[model samples]
Target: MTLLDNLLFSLSTTLPILLWLAGGHALKRTNRLSDAFIHDANRLVFTWCLPTLLFLNTARSSIVDSWQGDLIGYAAIFTLASIIVLWLITPLFTTDRSRRGVFVQGAYRGNMGIIGLAMVVNAFGTEVIPLASLYLAFITLIYNLAAIVVLQAGQTRLSPLKLVSQLFRNPLIIGVLLGLLWSITGWDLPGLANSTLQGLADLTLPVALICVGASLQFQSLRNNRYLVMIASGFKLIVIPVLAVGIAYLLGFRAEALGILFLMMASPTAAASFVMARAMTPWGELAAEIIVVTTFFSLLTTTLGLFMLRSLGWV
Candidate 1:
């Protein structure tokens, strides 16, 4: 694809996200969406829609056939490593304990399920869906567990046993586990069941994004601009450059290398704000990071892809 092609692809993937975000913000500003409604909607997405989305994506892939062991390994290890790096470095930027967790989570998490998958399919076509789905399953599991740990550590001390217990009870983790079981057993969801699950899964992103928008407050964002930029920079630029550079050196090439870059470069997940709100008091900071990274990733992703194309790396 040409540079223009790259630009259009970036726009296509991110534009709808911005539009939905704008709609939510407009509703909130105009009093069309109330605080109580946003709260309930967030609870609904976090508890049900997001998990169903995970299950459907994971269950639909035949992991045995679609598995890319090296690709999946790289994605998982890099995600954990990024979280650790952020955890260590975040303290230098802020002394606020609550904001520390929110900042670190925002910096490392990506919208891989939605934005990353779209970019991969557009770049490599439908043949990759199975592999991408499997990748999403593993990485998302890591993202949720890691987010909880960090956020909890930032807020208060907890025993490892208790944390493990809580993690297992999490709806997102349960969904991924069930999906993996289905994939392993090679069971097909009966037609009606599959359609119903898909319908519920489809609501995840839109509702999550709208809730993110409604939660956003301009005053909070402006006040936290410095931290917001730092998180956005890591999400869109630093993490991708470092991770993709290492992947290239480690012999990833063509489609594998491209997927790595796109996933790494994808903006902060909309779910970050939901997760923050549900788990901590710093959801506003997470919302700011999401909005900023979602906007700037258009430029960073396009330029990075163009450069990789020119270098014949992908």
Candidate 2:
């Protein structure tokens, strides 16, 4: 396909997410949806809907077909490199030590579970769910742990038991583990049960996008404007370019390369806000990062995919 074709397709594929986000934002402005409702909706989606979606997709995907250890390892390398680089550069960027973790996590830890998967499914197909799931499982863990360490830097002491307990309580982690275990069993749920779960899983993406839109507080970015811009730039631009280089060096191509790109290029996750709020006082910065990364992702991802497709890489 031509470059324009790729751009159009990319935009079309991603428009729904943007629209849902806008709708949510509009609803919030009009006061049609109360803050309490938005909060509850976010909680519901994170705790139940997202988990169901992850478990359903992972359990159903074929492990043998999707196994790509090299791809997984390479992606891990990208994630770690991002974390370390951001952490090292923290001092140069900001003086607010607590918000430093928010910036670092914002730069590297992408919305792989939501935006990444959606983009991959648009570009490739459902055949890649298992591979994506594996990548998601690995990075989600890394992101969570790294965020905690950075957020806790020179502040409250981190207890090993608390870390373990938090990991256990994290719904996403539990969903990934259960999904992998169920995939191992290879036992299909009865039709009625399966369909019921599928129905629940189907609600994840749209609801997530809307909640993200609703959660956004534009005024939050005002206090930390420059910081938000720098962090969002890293997430949307620098990181994706670096990821492309790594994928090429690792000889990833076609859907593998594309998924890797999504892994890198996708927006800052809404979950970042959740984690920031729970772990630090930097929730405002985290929310702004989400706003900037997600809105700009529309353009960056479109151009990124177009370039990749033009070269026959995705």
Candidate 3:
């Protein structure tokens, strides 16, 4: 396909999600969704719905057979590189220690569970879900590790044992682990159970998107207007370009390269705002970053996909 064709396709896949976000925003403006309901929905999405989706997708995919050692190693390296870069930059530019972690997480904590899977399915189809799932499992764990460290830094003492315990206990991580192990056992879920899992999984993305939209605080946008631009630039533009360049050097191509780029380029996670609100006073800035990047990705993602396709990479 031509570059224009690629851009159109990318926008088609991305626009539906954006509309959901817009729908949520409109709902809140009309008082159809109260803040209390939005908060509860966010919690539900993070805790139960997301894990169910991850587990169901990973369970159905041939994760063991499609497992790529390079995929894991590159994902780890990319995630660490992102964390280190964002962290180092945080101290130089920001004076508020409280907001530093939020900024760092904003730049690196991607909305993979939403945008990543959508991009993968649009470009490659369900056959590629296993690769994305495997990569998601590793990258997400690293994201949590980095978030905890940065958010807790220069403040309370961290217990290594506690951190380790939390990592393993993370519902998303747990789901991925169980899904992979269950896939290995080669025991299919009963038809009824599979359909039930699928039903729950289907709820995750739409609800997550709406929750994200409803949670956005415009006050945060006004407060951190410039910072939002900076974070959006880095999150949707700079990091993806740099990370994808590295992937190219490593000989990743086509869907693997495209999916990796999606992992890098997608908007900041909506959940980051949830954590930022719960952890520090920086939730406002995190929320602002999410809003900016989510909108920015609509344009950048299309362009990025066109460029990748032109390079014969995706």
Q: Tell me the tens digit of each residue's lDDT in model 2 across 1-314.
A: 56676667656656666788788778888898887886677677778887787677667755667778888888787788889989999789887777788889888878887778777876787777778877777677677667667766624666888867766677767776787788778788779978998898777766666766776677766878999999989999999898887778768888888888887898888777766765676766777787778778878988888888877777
lDDT of 3 by residue, 236-276 (tens): 98889988998899888888888888778888887687667
lDDT over C-alpha atoms for residue 55 of model 1: 92
What is the lDDT for 145 in model 2? Answer: 63
RMSD of each candidate?
0.8, 2.6, 2.5
* Candidate 3, superposed: residue stretches over 4 Å from native: none
lDDT against the true structure, per candidate, is: 0.92, 0.77, 0.78
Give the best candidate by lDDT: 1
TM-score-best of 1 and 2: 1
Name the lDDT of candidate 1: 0.92
**Residue-by-residue lDDT tens digits, candidate 1, 1-314:** 99999999999999999999988999999999999999999999989999999999999899999999999999899989989999999989999987888999899999999999999999999999998899888999999899889988899889999999988998888999999999999988999999999999999988988989888999999899999999998999999999889999999999999988988899999888988999998888998899999999999999999999899999
Query: After aligning candidate 3 to the native by TM-score, how far in Å is the CA of 290 from where it should be?
Result: 2.3
Ten-residue region with minimum lDDT total, candidate 3: 149-158
Sorted on lDDT, best first, the list reads 1, 3, 2
